[model samples]
Target: MAEREREPAGWQLEQSAPEAYERYLVPPMFAPWAERLIDATDFERDDRVLDVGCGTGIVARRITDRPGGVGTVVGLDINEKMLEVAETAAAKSQLEIEWRRGDVTDLPFSDGAFDVVLCQQALQFVTDPSAAFREMRRVLGPGGRVAASVWRPLEYNSGYVELAEALERHVGDDAETMMRSPFPEWTGEDLGTLVRDAGFSESLRTIEIGSMRYPSVEEFVRREAASSPLSEPLGNIEPDVREALIEEVRNALEDYIDDEGIVFPMESHLLTAQR
Candidate 1:
């Protein structure tokens, strides 16, 4: 018997990865965390601010919207597609944000150029986070502050654990690896040490606990895949395999599901310091 071939309707993302990321992931996960990261710093109205790895300009946009507004808000990212989306969004809102495409490890700016450096959920993806931290410190003036956030680990994010295991079982090791890459295995003390080694002073690491909610387990899987590199692979997989993967996650997260949808607690290490 031949298995029928059918594409899951939810798997169809009729937009670019960055666009989907802005539509799906930013609102739920990144935007709220952006607020927390901003709160960790002494962001003044007239201070020059730089948002490292500013995906879709959430943090940059938020800074401009703060009371009395901000001065010279710049958002830097390595992905051109993300920068394009960010530029368009800022222009639409008439925001004077400068979107620059550059690497965090080597910022294309002069020394002591910014007053505050804010990175939200991006330190983990850097190939050399310590170098990136040093660059952040270099761009900050004396008494400037740097605030960044990184997911604690997979163990602390149980929903992702179930999803990663299901991906390995049904998709492949590569898919599982892609899903788990965001959650770094670094402790709070390790984050403090990294920034201190990079010449940051008075480093403070705090564990911020938050929750993410999806309309359902299926939407959770669908949105996560659509917004990330997994979109192509998940969209290309056999429909039955995709179904099994979602089902496994659904069963595993049944306890977390409620009348609204699937809700799970997420944890991250917020590191703040002065340069």
Candidate 2:
């Protein structure tokens, strides 16, 4: 007997994971939060900073290279392939960020090993966020801070909303099935509750990062498509549907575009709590 094939229930597409995440995803989608994270965090030169689920070491490098040099910047991620890309980028940029392969929910760091813990856009994929938060809290020193940033509701982020609209038109209402992509969704209040539940005795505040615009609709699409998990499913879509979807996205951005190109706003919420 032959083995059974897995059935597609959700966003079952094999998505594209490209090196350009550092280039594209960083600018519009990620830059806002990265900057907010930097602002919210207070790191001394000798402080040890741990970046959880550090994708391509973007946040790690940012904290390490702040105004003063950090004592140690370590990035931990479950995906070695992502770490490989991160290491390559670090090496190319001449940054000495330590990239480690590990699970965020069960961090391997010693107790009170870090002065600051940062988790950016990583909580969504976590199977257990409370456990992940506890792990992050466990690694923080006394008076240390734990800061995390995650996507607001899809309705809050115009870029993602536009993408979803485009997908819905092409794949019909079923396109939302693609919404189950790797990107996790956690509200601002949810982030605060998680931090408090993890034993952080602190107040939580939601800070609006900012918005970004792409040069053109195609530019936005390429950036989104190249990095989107939905890209694979979109590619598998009949060419007619794919083209139609692209057109729908283009149409959605008409009100937001200028001579510079298509402009869309992306928003994120930052949650900070003390240990």
TM-score of each: 0.96, 0.87
Task: Kindly provide the TM-score of model 2 when superposed on the true structure, using C-alpha atoms.
Answer: 0.87
Give the runs in model 2 whose Cα sits over 4 Å from its true position: 1-16, 172-175, 180-185
Query: Model 1 off-target regions past 4 Å?
Result: 1-9
**Model 1 lDDT tens row, 1-275:** 11121223467777899999999898999889989988888867789999999989999999988887778999999999999999998999898999999999999999999999999989999999989999999999988999999998999999999999999999999999999999989999989889999988798889999999887788899888999998887877877887899899999999998877789999999989999
- Estimate the lDDT of model 2: 0.74
lDDT of 2 by residue, 104-204 (tens): 89999899999999989888888899999999999999989888887666766676687777767667565565553433566667777888888999956
> Which stretch of 10 consecutive residues in model 2 shows the poorest summed lDDT?
1-10
Measured by TM-score, the strongest candidate is 1
